[model samples]
Target chain A: MHYTEQSHTFRKIIMTKRITLADVAADAGVSAKTVSDVIHHRGRMREETRERVRNSMRALGYTTNLAARTLRTGSAKLIGLAIPNFAQPFNGNYADIVTSYAWAKGYRVSITTYHRLSQGLRELSADAYRFGVDGWIFLTDTPIPAQDNFLNQDRPVVLTGDYLSHGVADTIMFPNVEASQTATTRLFELGCERIGFIGAPANADSLDVTTQQLDAALTAQEGNSAMRLRGHLTALLQHNRSPLPSLVGACTRLDRSDGEKATLRLLDAGAQFDALFCANDAVALGAMSALTSRGLRIPEDVQIIGFDNTPDAAFSSPRLTTIDPFTEQYAQMAVDCLISRLEGDETAPTVHITDFALIERDSTRH
Target chain B: MHYTEQSHTFRKIIMTKRITLADVAADAGVSAKTVSDVIHHRGRMREETRERVRNSMRALGYTTNLAARTLRTGSAKLIGLAIPNFAQPFNGNYADIVTSYAWAKGYRVSITTYHRLSQGLRELSADAYRFGVDGWIFLTDTPIPAQDNFLNQDRPVVLTGDYLSHGVADTIMFPNVEASQTATTRLFELGCERIGFIGAPANADSLDVTTQQLDAALTAQEGNSAMRLRGHLTALLQHNRSPLPSLVGACTRLDRSDGEKATLRLLDAGAQFDALFCANDAVALGAMSALTSRGLRIPEDVQIIGFDNTPDAAFSSPRLTTIDPFTEQYAQMAVDCLISRLEGDETAPTVHITDFALIERDSTRH
Candidate 1:
């Protein structure tokens, strides 16, 4: 579609003369008021007249100016999603699902990521306002203060991922504790004893706080790694098995490289275990790689399990026995909650709990 | 942040007031024009007065109304990105990188996904205008029409992935042809006389169109899979090797399951091959799984390579040897091109080519 210089200039002149409702009305041989009424879908109009006006508008290349509409209605029909980072596979996948669902509900998504871990929640709140979204969904690992007035100001907010106790925001909490217990019990049922645990090794001291005390305290205050550790310990005690310090590997970050390093550390220290539980699927993958490199046969010599059944879990060698966090359901619930609030639901903030399931694969023998 | 009912009501009342420049000026003890000048940084002002006005604006909780500013300046300071599907790992990672970089440059990102493949490019054009973004960067696999008037109307657009010849939109094409040739040549250098190519096998007929004619023809009309096939054949001919039809495995989709299915069909048909090159990392991962499941040893029995060095590529059992398409750089280039256009660069539509590298790993012997 090569355009001559003269045609390009002509097109520019036409574009500068902005298409208006009056132009469409003139083209359709109708009053400007009738065109305006048809655009807003107000009052009654003949079907033939409405169709003619719409056709004329389309032919004239007229589009409603969104800026003017936003200014008049004070609504952008936009939703803001603030996350720690999308580099993590789980976060990226979640963002994709949420954005798709939101679009179906007639809302566009504006995404922002907090690259610095230290300032995640604070930065999220600040950026949410800058984006000027009608509503917001924030995913954070850090504990947000209860009195964070900026977050609770004017719009509906939904918190996801780790638990948070915000005054005005609804929350959808991941069932980390129950899911972890289920995975650990599954390992025991498979006739594996001396199970090893790999997760946030840096939080070992916090994990030592008895499960009862941890439960009694505000679970929202505890981080994700701490909650998973509690589940592992609770299940171990329930099965009449003691969790030895040597069998537990703590990692600073819950990623593949950290998982491998933590697993190798346990192995080098002469830790003996027949099964291993990891913080997430990434950790499990790294742990599996380390185990294989050391000449250990999976399911025969050791059973392994992980959390967040990511896409790669099913394709990894020996597959992966991991927990499915029900991310799709979580995203739907979060959006539904925000939409309800947007539609003028003034009820108290509710905590929506999501379910989890243990996906059995070749990593563990039945 | 627990808010009392009365406090919530008070906040709602304050929100209804809608802070304006006049309100800020009154609070700062200055004229409305002076406030406007400080907001826009139009002229020099005393540092002390500027600091006082900023503090007053913060105390009064005034935010620049984006809608009004956009209406006046005709710039939204927002960029829209249209992608095929975010569930795909590659697209998700690309979106993440692009969003991060765009944010650093002071532009917010609006993201929309085309769930239905059939209506991807057409729907993208419609949605981009509706979003009212300052500019757009579209990533598409479908062949867009050269004279897509909707896309070329009144905005800067940069197309990514696959070669396209849209007259007004800049293009940042992935180095598919050269990268495929390099991977195929590497297999030959390893002394593999018979190498199998598993990719969009549907392009087999189009692959026969000779490199010269294919290059001379509109490359945009050819899909990515076909271009990759041409590269494979070109490298084979350059090495004085003939590609056998029996050694080619065509896949309907570039996902893991399809890769596995394609590889199985090739194996079940008793195709003799000593090496394999997959279209992308996911397919390569699936092919590795299928090959290993059939009691084949990697490198020793069959060397393999894949494209797009996704995170999983490094963690796969053999740590897949694949091509790095420089997705981060591709994203940066696309965003930079659009930004330059947004900032008043009226030169001809430029075709930007990105570099690719073969990342050696355990999948192929060193």
Candidate 2:
């Protein structure tokens, strides 16, 4: 496949021009991709073709400009990650893990806050071409809309969160319901007859959720809140106990302050509970504060469990017992999927659910 | 004001050509920048020149290819932020604020973790052109070395941390010593004496530092640990009290676990202290756990204060009283400085020190 080209004519023309991959390709009588394959030592190319491209590159004096290739081809080795702001420990922990995993896969990450109230994936589609990222990893709280073809952007997308992806993109999630059920069952095993739930999806802030409302939420099953609520209720039902409305504290958001308000609302209603299962560590920490303010001691008087074994959980008073959702593995899965897609993998979109562990601490009895 | 060109010839020439800004400029007898200004409705230009460019655009049927301009010029309007992992609340808070401010100023942020132990700013300069960031803001632990000229990156550099910038880049810092001193003095004003310091920069894990060690560390004035330790000692000295070696707890890091370990070490040495001033809220939380474990009541027996009014500080039982270093303002300044430089401002590198406030809560007396 050695090209018998007249090198003299090509050399003279290249003297007045910056020799590009296209010039090398034309000289070698190969595609531009073959020239690039030879330069990067990547892709399947014949040995004879690689040699011809190399000889042409040397004759044309072509130097590969990394920036030029990126600009001209619009193929920046960059991954855009959209997560909620880092006030929540889960968001920060996930962001930290994603950055390491993205870099390890040879892609730099561009992170942005995906404020759900103000914007959605549908909005990003309007200007996705402007961002210049090869692919995207969106850790969204809301399930991406399938009707809008939100996942059908110019670049491939991989989602990481406890949300349904509508079979549109590669998704990474943890077993929210299963983990919540396991936590609840553990509390019951520890002889806790009345286990309250904090951070249940309330229709409004601090509203007492009715059984009818709970049923509707469960049937819809749109988010982690409903899924987690179902798990808590199932555990109680399996134990031959019915859930009490007062014990099920409802809050619109999952923050420490929200947890505190929920716990206070339960207390004000004279809800007698020996244990609490919160949506996240932040809410659990707030619950601890509310309980402590009322002179109820942890573990001895009331047991508490949190999710997302964040760093704060390890240091919280009583060293909050929490569910370790394996954020590291989840991040790794998301990055690997996105990278594979960028490298031309056309596999069917798959769902990746990471395993979880119950981290026992002073917050709960052994 | 309209261009008086051979309309038929120009229209025919542009009919086969996808009209570019350069084509419009040539038709109007102006520069490409003038055409850009007219399109964006920005920059100071004569009304006649604007009209001429607009008319040329209309006549030549020139549609703006925004992606083409960005790709060819390599102006992505992106800002790179290098920070430590988000396990630390301060890092997360700073990152959250930076994202909001950067977005408000019409720049998207690309974030990466800067591991001080592995890489430095000088290392980034080697590949700054590849990341496509217009400028960078580094939230670093180690002060940038002056000799390396790390500040002379291809993109502008802004720093936000406790470390000195060697006057190499615009730096955002909080008053560590002054804020720590104010926190200590507030405890004293509330009728507390024998205040203990936790999270000093010990040479090794749990190594006791002598007065000589303290003096040397103060003279160095490097990171938050040393600065915070100095403020505690200075406050004691100002109150005509000499700090007892046994009362000062030493730790290599400022994590919550480190705080707990340091508190235990002081207690084991039989140090009698009525108050404690911790390095950060994390350390303070750990200290709270330690005191509570030993039956030491907060405010009643051992009032405590912490630095960095993190979300954890607000929810801790006895609701930790800490110094609010104004993270919002610090992030704002860092992003603004970096954006200013990216927009071609050539002001001398300056130091920005944000103000601090001592937040009173249940951890301290009113």
lDDT of 2 by residue, B1-366 (tens): 355443322232114445678988898899999888876668998888888887676555453354445555657687888776676777777777888888888887767665421344444443444455667888776655555455554457897777777776788888898998898888899898788889888775447878777666556565888888888788888999876777777776577888898998888888899999998998898999899889899989999999989878888878999999998888899998988888889888999989999999999987
Residue A231 lDDT in candidate 2: 80
What proportion of the true contacts does each candidate reproduce? 0.27, 0.30
Clashing residue pair totals per candidate (backbone < 3 A): 5, 0
Going through the candidates in order, their DockQ values are 0.31, 0.18
Candidate 2 C-alpha error for residue A178, in Å: 1.3
Candidate 1 chain A lDDT trough over 10 residues, lowest sum: A5-14
Query: How well is each residue in A1-366 modelled by candidate 1, as lDDT tens digits?
Result: 223323322232123356777887897888999988776767688888887776565444465453455556656677787777655577877887788788778776766666542345544453343455777798876666554444564667798876665556788877888888899999999998889888753654643323344344224345667677778877988998766777777777687887888888888988899999998888899899889889998989999999988878888899999999898889989888888899999999988878999999999997
User: Residue B343 in model 2: shift from native, Å?
Assistant: 3.4
Listed in order, each prediction's TM-score against the native is: 0.86, 0.80
lDDT of 2 by residue, A238-305 (tens): 89887777788887668888999999989988999999999889889989989998999999999999
Docking class of 1: acceptable
lDDT of 1 by residue, B1-366 (tens): 223223322232224356788887887788888877776656677977776676555444565453455456667677888777655568777877888888778776766666642345554453443466777888876676654444565667788877575566788887888888899999999888888888753554542223344343224335667677778877878988766667777776687887888888889989888999998888899899899889998988999999989877888898899999899899999999989999999999988878989999999999
